[model samples]
Each structure stands twice: as C-alpha cells, then as structure tokens.
Target: MKIQNKKTCIAVLILVTIEQVIKIVINNNFLDKKFPILPGFLYFEPMFNRDYSWFNSMFQLGVSKWIHIVFGAIMIILVYLFYQYLNYQFGTIKIVNIMYAFIFSGAMCSLIDKIFWNGSLDYILVNGFFTFDLKDVYINIFSGLIILSVLLKNKVLNQIDDNIVKDFTKYILRKL
Candidate 1:
C-alpha cells in the first residue's frame, strides 16, 4: 500500500479506537449517572441509540438494525469513492486527506456501533436537543473543514467545472 493509504488507515483506526474506548468507559462507569457539564445545557448522559438517527426517531421510522448496518456500509463506500475522485482531481492534498480520514472514521465507528454495540453509545447530551458521541464529532469536524476549504477557495475546488462533474459521474458509474 502507498504511504498515504497507510496514514489514512492508521488515522481511521486511531479515531475508531478513541470512540470505542469512550463508549466502553461510558457504558461501564456512567450508564445510569448524569454529570452536568454546563448547568441546564450540557451533560454526560450515556444512552444506547437503537435508531439510525434523530431523523428516524423523530419521524418514527423504526428502522431495523440490519438496515442501519447496510446503510452505513453503503455510505462508507460512497465516501471512499468521493475521496478517490478528489484525489484524482487534486493529487494528494493533506487537508483533503485529513477531511477524508475524519469522515471515514466517523462512518466506520457508526458501522462498528451498529454491528457490535447493537447501536450507537451516545453519551453527550444537550438539554432539549439530542445526545451524541465522538463519532458525531469526527463527522462534524469533516463538515467544518469542508466549509473552511470552500471559504479559503482551495485550488482543487476552484478548478471544479461541469466537465469534472461529468467525468466524475462517469467514473463512479463505471466503478458501480
């Protein structure tokens, strides 16, 4: 494997391990305990989320575990394909790699949660909002980096055009 591939793998592994460790610690030690981080705002309240997401819960989708697992796998594949497209277009960019790593790690952790933990072990709670975990943070970091990259007008992104989109779509369709 290339060095970049190794780095991405290691980064993903480290991220996934961090999330799993936190989940385990929360599950074992603070399952029933709630520690307020900010009064009336934030708290550490561990809960097992069986649903796929807040959207599913809000809409009462009642999606099954297998569906979540399959969707997670599909998302991982799509993200990897998109990352490959970005690399092909921009060459090996460190920031893009980091962004890919974060999103990939989050997707991987979500998959692991679904397959092994039977759901996400969300620990952080926002009053009147929802509970989340480290995986969510990883994904959010990716989102923020994307916004920053756009705001900074990355060269790779600046070169984007209709032809690139068409070509990328062709490439993905071929791969599929």
Candidate 2:
C-alpha cells in the first residue's frame, strides 16, 4: 500500500504546487480588475466574503458589517477532521494520495484567504455559487471522491451474508 510510485507522487505534487501558485496570484491581483469569462454568467471577481456575509443570511448576529465567525470556524474544523480521517484510513494508498493532496491544498488555500482577506475567493460566478478557483474545485471533488470510496467499499462488501463473511469476520471480531 505504500506509495513508492514516482509518476503518481510527482503528478500530485505538481497539482498542489500549481494550486498554491494560483492562490498567490489571485490574492495579489484582486484589486486590479474583475475578469469576466462569460457575460452575465461567469467572472473572476476577487474579493473577500467577510464573516458578515454568511451571518446576514439568517441571524442578526449584532451588526450587518460583521458576519459570524462560527461559519469560518466550522469549515476549518470540518476540513481538519476530514484530513485526519483520510490520513488515518488510507495514508498508504496512492490513488487516495491524489485526493489527499487536493484536500490539503484546497483547505490551506481557503484558510489563507479567510485569515488575511476575511473570506475565500469568488473568482467565477454563475448563480449563487462561485467557482472561486481551481483549489476550491479540488476540495469539492476530493471530498466527494473520499465519500464515494467509503460508500463503494461498504456496498461491495455488504454483498456477502453473515455466513459467507464468517471467515473474514472471525479475525476482526477476535480483535474486538
């Protein structure tokens, strides 16, 4: 299960590196201009969402200018927990190594923006959701893949009945 595969490792490193570079550029060039990729649809508008934006959705939370920090804290905590579980469960699996890289980089990217800019990037817009950047995309995709992997693994294994799985469960139950 150890990932000694040079090709896969290098590719994932390249992806994480690229994501960091994009984040740097976006943070720097934010005030320059809003690059619209598609009229009335998608545009690269670099700005912070501020803690106020999310808080305004439901609760008053005091002032309109300041949004609640609860959302940000929750997101950061969730990302951290996800990282811990993934590392513990599949640290040696290379196919999952890519997913891990994506999650780590994306979470870091958002954390950076939130810390300094008070929000994450909103680069591409369509309706309510913004593409933000590739890092954000990586976060979503990798999270989905992780969930899918767990679901698929369980579903495939559940095909066996208790009698059929007796051999496998013997050692597992013994460990219990």
Measured by TM-score, the strongest candidate is: 1
Which ten contiguous residues of candidate 1 have the minimum total lDDT?
A: 1-10
Q: Summarize candidate 1's per-residue lDDT along 31-141 as a digit string, tens digits.
A: 999899998999998898888666777788998889888888999987888788877667788888899899999999989988999888898899999999999999999
Give the TM-score comparing model 2 with the true structure, all chains together.
Answer: 0.53
- Judged by whole-model lDDT over C-alpha atoms, candidate 2 comes out at 0.56
The lDDT for every candidate, in the order shown, is 0.86, 0.56
Clash pairs, model 2 backbone: 51-67, 52-67
By lDDT, who's the top model here?
Answer: 1
Candidate 1 local distance difference test against the native = 0.86
The TM-scores of all predictions, comma-separated, are 0.90, 0.53
Candidate 1 residue spans exceeding 4 A from truth: 1-3, 163-165, 173-176
Residue 76 displacement in candidate 1 (angstroms): 0.5
